[model samples]
Target: MSAAPQMNAQHINAITNAAVIIVKEHLGMQTGFSKPYVSGSQFMSSDISVVMGVNGTLEGQIICTMKNQTALSIVGSMMGGMKVETLDEMGWSAIQEFGNWVAGRAASELAKAEAAIDISPPVINEGRSTFRVEKTFLTIPLTSEAGEVLLHVSITPRVNE
Candidate 1:
C-alpha cells in the first residue's frame, strides 16, 4: 500500500466552492462557509447526513450533514416551498438528490482543475452517527438561512498499481 494523496489548497477550494454553488443554485439560498480544517479518521455526523463515495482520480467520501429541521427546510425549498414537517419517502429522495447535485457539481469543478473524478450514489443517514475512515477529512461548515450544513470531504488521489 502507498501513502495517501495529500489534498492541496486548490482541491479544497474547488470542493468548498462546489458546495456553496450548489446551495445557492439548487436551494436558492446563499451560503457562507467557515475556515476548513483537518479532522481525524472519525467524523461525528449531525441529525441527517448524505454520504457519497468518490472514485477515479480521487478516492474517499463526501458527507453532507445537518440538523433534521435543516433537512426539512432544504427539502421544502427543493419542493418549491412546500412545507415539510417530516421526511417522507419522497422527502428522503429529495435529500439524496441534493447530495447528487453537490457531487456532480464537485466533479465538474474538480475536472476544471484537471482532476477527473466519479461520485457514487448518495446514501442518506437519519439521526446522529459516527463515520470512521482510514484517511483524514477536511471539514467545512456552511451557514445559510435554512441552517448550518457541514460538508465533510475526505479524498485522496487514487494510486495505480
Candidate 2:
C-alpha cells in the first residue's frame, strides 16, 4: 500500500466553505457546521448520498449525505418551493446537479489556494450503506433549517508518479 499523503488544512477549509456557501446561496438555507472528526475504516452513510471523486493535487472522495426527507425538502427548495413528495427522475437529477455545484465550487476554492484539482461527476447513492476505504475520512456535519447534511471528505495530496 502507498503511504498516506498529508491532508492540508487549506484543502479542508476550502471544501467545507464551498459546501456551506452552496447551501446558503443555492438552497437558501443558513447552515452551521459542527467540529470535524475523523472516521476510521468505514463510514455509515445516510439514506441518500451524493458522492464525487477528486483528483489532481488532491485525491479521494467528497460525499454529501442526508436523510430521505431532507433530500426531498432540498429538491423542493431547488424547484422553487414545489413540494417533492417523492424523488422522481427529475428530483434525482436535481440532486446530482446540487452535488456538481458543490464540487465545482470546491474546485474553484482550492484553485484560489493554488491547489489545482479535477472533480468527477456526482453519483447518487440511495438507501443506507457502509462506505469502506483504506483511507480515513473527515466528516463535517452541517446543520441547516432544512436538515442536517454530513460532508464526508477523504482527500490527500497526490503522490508523484
Query: Which prediction has the highest TM-score against the true structure?
Result: 2
Summarize candidate 2's per-residue lDDT along 90-146 as a digit string, tens digits: 999999998999999999999998989899999999999999988889999999987
Highest-scoring model, lDDT: 2
Q: How high is the CA lDDT of each candidate model?
A: 0.90, 0.92
Clash pairs for candidate 1: none
lDDT of 1 by residue, 62-148 (tens): 999999999999999999989999999999999999899989999999998888999999999988999888889888999999899
Backbone clashes in model 2:
0
Query: Candidate 2 has what TM-score?
Result: 0.96
**lDDT for position 85 in model 1:** 100
